[model samples]
Target: MQVAQATEVRKNWSSFFDQVVHDKPQAVRRNRDTALFLSKTHMEEILSQYRFTLEYEIEEDGYYSGGLKEIDICWSEPSLEELKQTIAKDLVEYAKTYMDNFALYHNAPNRRDHFPYVMHVLMKDNIQEVVELIDADWERT
Candidate 1:
């Protein structure tokens, strides 16, 4: 293993990568061991110890208000009962999804223009084989 200062590695990243590809693993550090630069084959071997899967999902549209959309507020004085009802309604909506679940996110809209998405998780066990096939495709590209 070779040791390299993090700043030195950053300044000559291409040469560092070339060294890692042809020579040996390089340990890059600042105050402590920060990262390791390893050969592709070594990286594959390390990754082989754990299982990985390629995930595919279809994004389905859901309700979303783009951040630019704003609600207009009425400044008219309201009775105490009306104020209580408004607060209650807001509390219900917050408990249903707003408080914990709903958050702002942006992505390319679906076929029918909409922002929110429903993600489906898909996994395959043959990750290494798939990665090699993708790598071949990448080389051609």
Candidate 2:
């Protein structure tokens, strides 16, 4: 959880490598404003701990709705809390925005379709569940 400027990281690449070997991840900041991270083993370990599936369905318009279906049961690691928080925040915002937009367009429709309110509500509900799951830290194991 150490923070270093991007320039500092570039200047001390060897030290950063040593830190990674020692299981210490470093956050590199650019222009003292934006931050990036460097942690090879940590990333690999996280990836190894998760499983992913792709789910797709054909829509009425002959297009496909595809999503990454991630199945992971382990979230006990401290680093995962940040990920959970991010997911929760994103879901909450998404749900709110979708509802706002749906309200605006509930009466409008294209020639081929009816009201899209139901679909938007379903999406909002799904996002709400994601937010709740993240907040509860409800992993399978």
Candidate 3:
């Protein structure tokens, strides 16, 4: 990866684009790595090398219990925004079903190591609360 200053990149983006095209990866630094620019082919290859796992717990109405679901995402070189959007879409689908039993099983607060997982049981009648909770967690991640 080639390191380029943010100011330099901003001042001459066409040159930076050419550098990224030739070098494959260029780290744009502004005190820290603000962004990494890469050729489309190179970016896809990098993304294809990793397997991302997303795990979450939800209530099951039939079992009156909680279950952990693990989702494995294999990205074929999508942009960061695209990856986040895909994950958010998948999470919403799973969240809607699991959250139906939220009131049935998790009607009280439980001690969790994670601060955000420590939820207070409030609105028992609405599924919107669960949706909001899931959305909030998604955003945080």
C-alpha TM-score for every candidate: 0.33, 0.32, 0.35
lDDT agreement with native, every candidate = 0.38, 0.45, 0.44
Task: Please give the distance, in angstroms, between residue 138's alpha carbon in candidate 1 and its true position after superposition.
Answer: 36
lDDT of each residue in 1-141, candidate 1, tens digit only = 557898898899999998899887889989875788788676665544332121212223321111101111111113323323343333233333322343432232221121111110011123233222111001111
Once fitted onto the true fold, the runs of candidate 3 whose alpha carbons sit more than 4 angstroms away are 50-141
Best-to-worst order by TM-score is 3, 1, 2
Q: After superposition, how far is residue 5 of candidate 2 from its true place, in Å?
A: 1.5
Q: What is the lDDT of residue 20 in candidate 3?
A: 83
Counting clashing residue pairs in each candidate, in order, gives: 0, 0, 0
Model 3, residue 80: displacement in angstroms? 30
The best candidate by lDDT is 2
Worst 10 residues of 2 by lDDT: 111-120
